[model samples]
Target: MVETGNRYMDNVSKLISWGHWFSFINILFALVIATRYLVAADWPPSLLGQGYMLVSWLGHFSFLGFAFYLLLIFPISFLVPNEKAMRLIAVFIATVGTTTLLLDTQSFTLFNFHLNPLVWNYLFGGEGPQATNLLFIAIPFIFLLQLTASGLIWRNLKTLHQKKLGPVIATSLFVAFLLTHTIHIWADASYYRPITMQKANFPLSYPMTAKTFLIRHGWMQQNEQEKSNRHTHPGREIKYPLRAIEVNQPQPKMNVLLVMIDALRADMLNPTNMPALSQFAGSASTFNHHFSGSNHARLGIFTTFYGLPSQYWPDISDAYTPPILMTQLQQAGYQFGLFSGQGFLQPEHMQTSFNSIEQLNMAEPISPVYDGDTQAVKQWQQWLNQQNNNGAPWFSYLYLNTPTGMEVPPEFDGPHQPTSTMLQAQQAGPESLIKGLFNDYQNAVLFTDQQLNRVFTTLAQLSALENTIVIVTSAHGQEFDDTGNNNWGHQSNYAWAQTQVPLVIHWPGKTPIQVDKDTSHLDIVPTLMQGLFETTTASRYYTSGLNLFGPLKRDFILLGDEENYVVYQADRITEFTPKGNAYVLDRNYHELENAEPDIQVLMKVLNELRRFYPNN
Candidate 1:
């Protein structure tokens, strides 16, 4: 009878030890969740059969890590505990985690289809948050049950002569993972992409590890975030200081006219047929290496106009503030007008910033249709004439979308065997019916350039040419390769062809300063401000923008597509640099990428931002 009792006690002791380690494993998974949430600012929802949503999109990545960790460490959780019970615990932890992921995903989908108006709308027909009620209940049981079981088992092991290394390693990883899961429960959490940021300064951690990260990464070297911004804004309070100093450049009140020819490439302009743009490029400060924020018109327009890079805000279409240049110019009594053929319906966010928004008011397509040069020339001349009616000098923002149509690839390249979804859609457009569609598309671009010529001619005719600073650029660049790598459309891929854009600044009063260095579309705002206010500007006080007219040359241009992020180094234009290397593109701005090159960081952030803003 005494021998039987000893065996029973041994079984309990072993069971307790096993539970403790298993609990730690569960905690490790939790840490992964926390870390992702800290970086992403939320959990991932499952996708397809799994959970996935904007805020929770990073979970897909976390899921990969979790699976790896599980496969490697899970078997050990049962080394000392009941094998059947340990398996059940594993199932419980996984099931609950999976549930959380899926619930988050479902929330995003429902929010997108039901709450968003930008897409062909769908209604919320599911149980909504109520559908995941079971997950909330299961999560705690799985988490707490393991936590309690772990503590009891740890006490039992101490009583016996038990080796704790296996338990220690397993439990340590588990706890770290669990804590990581909860890292962002606090407000004002900032995420750092170790590779993309010039300084690999990650923000916030628990007592034992926080200082270590800051010290190790040399976070103090260039702590831009710690610098006080406090710019002397005209009407608003910003972070960057633009006050208590005067610059010799033109005042902020200078009548500045910015024209964005959608999808205009650097080589797209020819001086002979499109002499006006060529004149601007020749006479003005030409940025032969200017790149756009995104390859899409929506992201391009917002970034170039607002003086904020597209990577900062995922949902560009919803950001409504006027481009700092326009806002400052307006404060200085400049009239603003935005003319587009597609109507502001696409970049609907334009309404909040643009003073006058006019589309292609058509009873019928004008004889030349879409991007008609003669009609554009006539209209621009008339609009240029109208600027004088209001005693205010004008700051015109013209966005022309004539050559904006997509073209079918003559070949195939991409994820599948050529789904060609977008190309097929483009084939249905009017360009498809036209002979030599690509040639016609090129002609449309030439015509658009010609129309811009009319604006220049009218400016000269009105004698407004000498007084104005004309900026000729494009929102995004387009593509036509049927290559397998085609992400389809602008800004979708991280390739140079998608983001490279034309930048020409013709300041009549200044001597030629050829800016052949790499520059971003965001610099347009600060550069214009330098010409106008002759001062600095930032979102708060520490705006990262460099003065467009400054002598600084950038070695890298940080590029982001909703799913991918990369720092395209200017000096190494022909090749990719070692990841994590900091490089400057133009004066005043530098970019950082991680040691491990993963462009997906930008893509994930973009997807999340899209999910958050407008809940779309």
Candidate 2:
């Protein structure tokens, strides 16, 4: 019996020894991860010059990694006495941790963001099949690597007696790290500024709760004041499903057709490529210096419908806030129809806003882009024909994804082709093949123009043009390395090349007025309400825009995506980036090194943001 007891003790001793060694290896792995994060941050020289800031970030990451490993892996490894069970548990934990790291790396490469709930949904919820497939392919490799490491840990076993010293030391250090990190967060939050630099140091370090606490306690100034104002006002809960607006006059009984083309740059409107749209612009109210509410389709379309900035999207979408414009039109007895070439839910989760849409033409080109556009337009025409004699005011929304793919029929293909060298340079380096890419995009635009001609011709044939109000625009503009910064797509930046778009409104019996002043997508819903319904009541419910018929009331326009915001004024532009850096630029987008941030303008914008999204 004594010998049996001795044998059991020997086995446990071996297991504990293996556990400690493996735990130490995890600490080393944590160090490697911290190093990788620093490299990925790519901090600017200005930021690096802040000696205390640099030291704080480094110390924070190092302590975070050490604490996490000691608190988690060390406890598990040391406590499990059975050798086989310990190995299994350790391998499982390692696999999960490694997988998370891989996903974070991929997300940063693609979107300059870490993995979050929204991005996770996009990955697993049937969007970007090619990218998802590639991720799955790489998973097996990650698992194999994890398994090899686990094997090494198992093989390098040693005999060791049970001890409490290591656990006590590790636990104390973990507590100290936690206290230090919390204090750092509290100190940063009290300053009334975003903790952007801390966020960049490690993923998911936003200090959200700490900031809220500071604001609530009056420790912060700028944002705290704005937040206090929101709750103090009577009936400040933003009314949605907007109070059924009472039109003072009988609404104009006209067929409304809104065509939103994708990625059609303002400069692409030319006689050769977009002849139809250019000609249409002549007899329509053209907003020549118009900008989108955002540089991406999700926010752009939301802004047009909601008449608000993209920052309000989460509130309206998550709560299923039916667009006031749509609800008002519905109350006025208008039937709605929607046709989209791309699946409305992909890339942006727009289905959250337009919840009642049942049928969608979510087909893409199997060969040529024109073929797909042709089919979508024909389907729209058929749908329009069915509504011809209903005698009810009708609203149709057509979203074309033709130019989004930058493909065209052979006959419409332009003369430029990217050379092999140019393609290689673009893929490997920062050089852009702009000429070739623009040619392809423009050819696609030409094909889209032909499709537009077909729609108008069909409307004329059906006698719908006599009373229909046709409004034409694009969701956002495309980029072609315009800044020589290798930005070749929309939604990647808030530059003018990506945000500026064309807006042409055609109301029956209305004079064509070309307005060259700056305008924005926020002006759309209010303009339609005033022009078509002659109703101004919806403006009372926190609408961020004024009717286009009035003089420009705002001296500046706001633009943004998920990660950054920009304020564009007459002579200059101010950009607020995710890493807490502010950039000032000239009208032409050239950086002004000596320009100071316009704090008043920034504060005004931030106040509006807090007013709209108090809880975010």
Candidate 3:
């Protein structure tokens, strides 16, 4: 019996030793995996930026990983108090953690941003059968991968129980993580050197509030805090609530028609290219210095609807942020007809913008469908003609994406023959090719004007123009390498070429006039609300926009994109970037290298922006 007992003890010792070896192997394996994440691009714009990115990547990820190990995984391994049981728990945790990390890597590759609520909402929220089928197909492969990771983790944990080196290595990793993470956050806050901000959406990142702290201490400008706040959601307490709208006078029941031509630059509305629109603008109220709420379509549309900036999208989306605008219109019995060139009411949550919206199922044909601005417009015309004259006021939204896609009928494609097509022109680096691209964009505008003429003629034929308030604008403007750094897209920059768009309002009883005061897309909904309801001018202050007929709110206006926020006042424009970079430019979009900033104007603009977000 004694000899048998000794033999059993000897076997147990061998098993424990084997477990230790396996644990060491997994530690090495995990290190290799971590190293893959630590690797970065060699071509950072600056040496400081390169170092900041590297340290931030290593420190933030490593620290986060070590924290999980110590707080969650390690406790589970030792708390069980049974060698075999502890090993089982440890293996399970390690497998899950490893799988999550792998999945994150794959997600980062697929989308520039990290895995977040937005991605999940897009993937599984409404994709229906496709998302389900994809999950079904992936389950088997994921299960096999998990099993393989579990086997490795089991061996690793068994071996780790026999050694003290595990704790020592973990301590070393934790220390390194702390050092790098501190440097990353501090640099971002103090120097505005966007170290970790390049990956601001990295999984589980703590929001950076150090900039606010710095501002309070008088160590840094409040500009950083303002820009940061633009990305945050508003609180539960609504800033702009439903106030009783006091009307100035009695008004007739009128129909409102909004026609948005995508990427129509303010300078491009000419007698030559867009003759029809030019002729209409000549007799309408045109804002010569109008700017888009944002440089991109999604945010621009969000601003137009909410009468606020894009930062409010998340919170506002959760519950109707400013439900009063649309609800009031609906209550007043305004029939709505919403049309879009591309898919509208998407991201699902934005459906709140309209009360019972109807969409047209029209595809963009390869060839021009008879000089039409968009298939949606043609469908809308047909739908409009069929509606019974029920004497109810109506609101119709017509969106045309012509200059955006730069597509036109072959009949209208003459006068701007380029050396290459749009796709090739984008890659062709010559100045002439860039000019050719701009020419194509202009030709597209002309084609859209022709299509608008059809809509105008139809309205005239139906006598709808007599009582209709026609408002023409755009979601945002486009770029054609106008900035000289190969910036050929709308969302790429916040320069005048990308933010400036024309706004033309043709009120039935109002006379034609050109307004040079700076205006924005935010003013559209408020203007419509006031005009439709005959609200007093003072009520416009409730919105972020000023009444076109009232005094200007301030000298400057705030505009933004996903990556940039800008303040434009007078001829000088100030752009604030996520990486803490700020620059001033003249009206011509030329960088004013040594020009002194208008601090007063900048602060006023920033203060207005801070009102939208509570935290800043």
Task: Give the TM-score of each candidate.
Answer: 0.55, 0.61, 0.60
| Predicted model with the maximum lDDT | 2
TM-score, ranked from best to worst: 2, 3, 1
Q: Count of backbone clashes for each model? A: 62, 0, 5
After superposition, the stretches of candidate 2 with alpha carbons farther than 4 Å from their true spots are: 1-246, 249-252, 347-350, 358-368, 411-433, 538-542, 578-580, 613-616
Clashing pairs in 2: none
Expressed as tens digits, the lDDT of each residue in 1-616 for candidate 1 is 0124565455545554554454445545555444433333222121211121222323223344456335633444535345455545555555565445434433334321111221111112232345445546666666665556555555655553255476466454445444433432210112222111111111122212243455466753223421211111111112212333333543344577777777776667666435568776777788777888777776677666665545444322222334445555545655655554444544334333352333323233333234333444465567778876665677665667666653212331222222234445556553343323445456556656657867877777778867788888887776554233534446555455667877888787888677767788767766666667765333223133467777655445555543334456533321122222222232212123323222233233334334322212
Q: What's the lDDT for all of these models?
A: 0.49, 0.66, 0.63
Residue 516 error, candidate 1, Å: 2.1
lDDT digits (tens) for residues 13-59 of candidate 3: 43444344434444444455545444422223345555655555555
Residue-wise C-alpha lDDT for candidate 2, range 1-616, written one tens digit per residue: 0124665566555655555555555555544655555555434223322333344444454454455546765576556767777677766676676567656655554434577654465556665336655766766775676566666866644221234455674665456446445645554553312223344556655433466776677777755543342223111123443445666645568879989888888887767778898887777788888988998888888888877777667445534566767766776777777766554554233444455444543454334546656777887899889889788888898778778888876565454466324476667433344555676687778888889998888888998978888988888999987876767789777778888998888888888898888898988888887778787476645467777767787868888865576889988888876543578997667898888666567656755554553331
Residue 199, candidate 1: Cα error in Å is: 24
Compared with the true structure, the alpha-carbon lDDT of candidate 2 equals 0.66
